[model samples]
Target chain A: MRDRPATEARILEAAQAILIAAGPGGFGVNAVAREAGVDKQLIYRYYGGLDGLLEALGVRLAQWWQEKLMAGLPQTPVENYGELIELLALQLLHIVRSEPLALQSLLWELTGSESFVKSLSASRARAYGAWMAGVRGGLEPPEDVDAPAINALLIAAISQIALAGRQADTIIGLPTNDPATWDRLEKSLLRLVRGVYARP
Target chain B: MRDRPATEARILEAAQAILIAAGPGGFGVNAVAREAGVDKQLIYRYYGGLDGLLEALGVRLAQWWQEKLMAGLPQTPVENYGELIELLALQLLHIVRSEPLALQSLLWELTGSESFVKSLSASRARAYGAWMAGVRGGLEPPEDVDAPAINALLIAAISQIALAGRQADTIIGLPTNDPATWDRLEKSLLRLVRGVYARP
Candidate 1:
């Protein structure tokens, strides 16, 4: 009774851990109780139901996106547009590559048409957009730059490569599993960024 | 008795149709027999089994890629690198958006780990690389431009949008279902091209 907040926090953290590890499919009250070391009845009492637990988790995930995604980055505004993109893009690539939640959420977003997933997608979209904007800071490209489109393209490319590479080592013989390939990709990306985005 | 060539052609065509429409999951000897309007035994007798038929269909698909993917494009090389990429990216968008086969093949390639799909992926990769090279013709980007990376990014972006747009009306509030969004993407892509790739 005295540690209600601590208990709830433990439950939510466990829930998030499962969600990241196995995605939506593996989410279950039984698993949560087991992982959180709480009785199943406790979950029912604290959250009212499985849906309630899920909803709260969604909110928590959103807040975490802001905190974790924002903290410890180079916050100084980058005047060099190309370098800014490279920095932001590399950050995105690192997260997507290492974070199972991002990939799982993406898969769940695309596959599920349910209202729950839709709402989740909407919130994620907002969070992601905000994250991008926050990371970008005061960096502004020249008048001729199409920042939005370029950003979308870079995100799409990085995401697809990461997603597709999960099933195989190579996407179109690119050997995506190799770090050297990423280096090549980075080298090329930097070159293009330098070429297109004006140097400050 | 006299139409062995035609009957074989019909069966192969039906197989391709099924592969495109239903992907690998719907592929069945019985389905092919029914679609081709021939006895199931004929498929076994002619192709020597389903594997043979699949192999033949793979060959036919490769040939069709050469014939159809290459036909009627502006073969004339554009010295302007930006315009060249825009042209190719648009074509990829068009095909992926319109052709169920391309989408199906992509799905099949990613999801299936069997030898058959791997072979199909390999052949398709060869054909795609060839088509890209053939399309570029004599055009060349400046030494500063990272053409390969840019090309990979462009293809990834176009493909991801088209693929994800299959399930939902929008991707991260992009309104991908609308044609105008594509236009905006195009406008931005061209701008990036101009910014990066030098003029003729």
Candidate 2:
């Protein structure tokens, strides 16, 4: 018999592959089992069912993002809020570029009606809230700056641009699929964030 | 015998209703015929087929958006770019709030993998490009500003917030579903665009 933990990991990986490759429609037990080379019954025995498996996948993805964000965070607090803002923007862009599947999951969640998606969104908000609180403690925000709103705008912009780039290489005259375009975008985003947070 | 023009209009209306209510999945020829109380053969005879019907729906939706945007545009162009920027932001926010079906169609297009979706996006890009050209003609954009990039960011942010608000009422601590929250968001977005384009 296959080792239990190994088999479970394989199943989860297979499920994620299917989700990224064919979206929700192709995420069936039969397809996952075939991809993982495991018995379909093991999925039921280990995870209860498809919904349960999806929940587990969601949990795994969330943990992955948390860990990635934490890794990119500054080791110690910085004196300049502008520098911090730039760092945060770059880190976010990096994560979006590196984790295409994660971005897809996020875009999928926007239209998804599943309870799992709701809980995942809530958890992400809480995690981000905590991070913002930590950053706020160390940095002095400008009088007009609404830090959370700016962060939300930044995240939403990055996510949408990356997702839309897949089909439409250019949007609003920006070359979304080109590396030079992304570099320019990253620089412009950094400048924009600094401009907002810069003291009068 | 039914009037050809009237029957075609009815079919198109039925297709639009289906798109808004059930999204693309429910926009099949069969469902549309049932919704319109028309014979299945009538759809084939009126619009040629499903693809033709969809193209007609796309054209209708595009026309609707162009009219709405034109109605919202300033009758006399402002000399100040900052005011123009704020006006554009508010107009975009209004469009997102007013056109729920259009927003749904946009989100569906993001996840959709069809030739029709691609052509629709290209057409939209062209439409927005034309609008931007007209706006640029009257007002001078800031030297540091990349108008298209800024426009893309604003559009993406609005679209994501509106689409995600349907599933999760709050994102990154922003209360998306509440009207008061949107008021705050609109003001903040105006400030952001102005800050980005403001002269040194």
Candidate 3:
């Protein structure tokens, strides 16, 4: 119990590494303990078990993701939603590339666990709802905007980009610090968002 | 040998099943032979080794994927790229959902093998080059729509949506045939495309 706080952080870090290397199915207690250089019993005592560890990690990752997503957006609101989307896409690519392991772990759990999947959907719904509230600069989506639909689309699109960024990293064996492909991705996303948000 | 064709087909089928169940690393000669209900020795007689099997599978699967992707496009090109994008999104969602096993295998190899990744990049370049040739239907892009840039965006956006669709199937345990989600996605994508293709 004395080492509980540090143990939690260590377990999360170790879990992220295990997930990055072997995905969700490979997240074993022994592996995590060994990776963390901690006692197995300490992991059990600190996080309760694998499920608890995953739950904590999921919550942590979601908050981090939302914060990173919201970081590039202006505090108030903008008339052009495309601008926001473009920023969001670049920010998303940046964040995922920065923290590939955590994002990959979340994605793996999204595929591997039903409970985790539900949690992810709920969390996403909440985040998008919040984002939409801010999208029109406090006012709801304009009549022609189809706010809910737009929100869903943006969430889906950005989520895909973030995931694809991870896949791109794996494919080209690029380091997180490299911004070459990211520059290309950012340009493309800007065009796509402009397509969605620019006036007809 | 006399059963070369049969042996090759069996190997391909086995690789697909393994990809669906355990991904690329789990695909071994022993597993493939077992799954195909054939002698292990036959794998060597026909394919020479595991790498051969992977190469043969890659060629076969890539060809199959290309055919499947081209199956549902409008017979003739439409002036409004937005409508075409919607159609393409729906078609892609259908393809990704229905062919999860194949997609999984293709993605696994695309990221895992260096030579395969190079070929995949070349294939993508060709597809993008072709798409850019048709970027101008009636509307003009706000900025110069370079082939690489447009391709990167279009490919990223489409890939993201497809990945979402797959997750809805494999992770969220949602019905892959749910037209409502696809319909919503199509509208959003169409709007995005329109926003991009609109006159500056």
Top model number, TM-score: 2
Q: Which parts of model 1 are misplaced by more than 4 Å?
A: A1-68, A80-83, A133-139, B1-68, B80-83, B135-141
lDDT of 1: 0.71
Error of 2 at A114 (Å): 0.7
lDDT of 3 by residue, A1-200 (tens): 45667777888888778877866556789999899888888777878887777777677766765665566666655656556555555655566657766456446633553466556555655554455455546433346665455545554454554554444442222222466655665676666666555544
Worst 10 residues of 3 chain B by lDDT: B167-176
TM-score versus the correct structure, for each prediction: 0.73, 0.90, 0.76
- Candidate 2: the clashing residue pairs are none
Q: Looking at model 2 chain B, report the run of 10 residues with the lowest lDDT sum.
A: B129-138
- Supply the DockQ value of model 3: 0.33
Residues A33-147, candidate 1, lDDT per residue (tens digit)?
8899888788888998787887787677666655655653566766565676777677767777787777766655544454566667567567656766766656577777666
Angstrom error at residue A7, model 1: 12
* DockQ winner: 2
Highest lDDT: which candidate?
2
| Ranking 2 against 3 by DockQ, winner | 2
Candidate 1 chain A worst ten-residue window by lDDT: A107-116
Residues B92-113, candidate 1: write the lDDT tens digits: 7777778877766665555455
| CAPRI quality of model 2 | medium
Please give the interface root mean square deviation for model 1, in Å: 2.8
